[model samples]
Target: MRLDKFLKVSRLIKRRTLAKEVCDQGRVSVNGKPAKAGTNVAVGDEISIRFGQKTVTARVEAIRESVKKEDAGQMFTIVKEEPTVEEEQASSNL
Candidate 1:
């Protein structure tokens, strides 16, 4: 499955176009390597996405054309989520 499609269908990014834009800007990576919107994804592939102040890493569990909202979370397993250096520092000082 395409990275952008998978991101949208899994509700990771909410929209396919946004996923493509994020990928194009190099905010998305697969298996530790930067990935493009058209990148192919398979089960077990680890995907990491940068979202402003935080980064979310998830492992692909399944690839489907479509899934219900309630089933979306089953598509990937969140490995970890951490704030960016700046965010972490700011929070630490609070």
Candidate 2:
């Protein structure tokens, strides 16, 4: 599956255009290498995405043309999630 499509289908970015933009800006990587919006992805591939101060890493579990919202999360397994600096600061105040 294309990286952008996979991102959309997996509900990672919510929109295809945004996922492309993110990829064009070099904010996403596949298997530790920079990937383009049209990059090919396969099962078990590691995808790392940067969202401002936070970084999320997920392993591709399944690829489907269409999936229900309830099953979206099942398409990939989150390997790691690095909290944003602001979130960490807020938590420390508690």
Query: Which number leads on lDDT?
Result: 1
lDDT of each model, Cα atoms only? 0.98, 0.96
Candidate 2 TM-score over all chains jointly: 0.87
List the lowest-lDDT window of 10 residues for candidate 2: 83-92
| Candidate 2 residue spans exceeding 4 A from truth | 83-94
Total clashes, candidate 2?
Answer: 0
Residues 1-94 of candidate 1 have per-residue lDDT tens digits of 9999999999999999999999999999999999999999999999999999999999999999999999999999999999977899999999
Candidate 1 ranges beyond 4 A from true positions: 89-94
**Model 1 scores what on Cα lDDT?**
0.98
Candidate 1 has what TM-score?
Answer: 0.92
Q: Give the Å shift of residue 45 in candidate 2.
A: 0.2
Relative to the true structure, candidate 1 has a C-alpha RMSD (angstroms) of 1.6
| RMSD to native, candidate 2 | 3.1
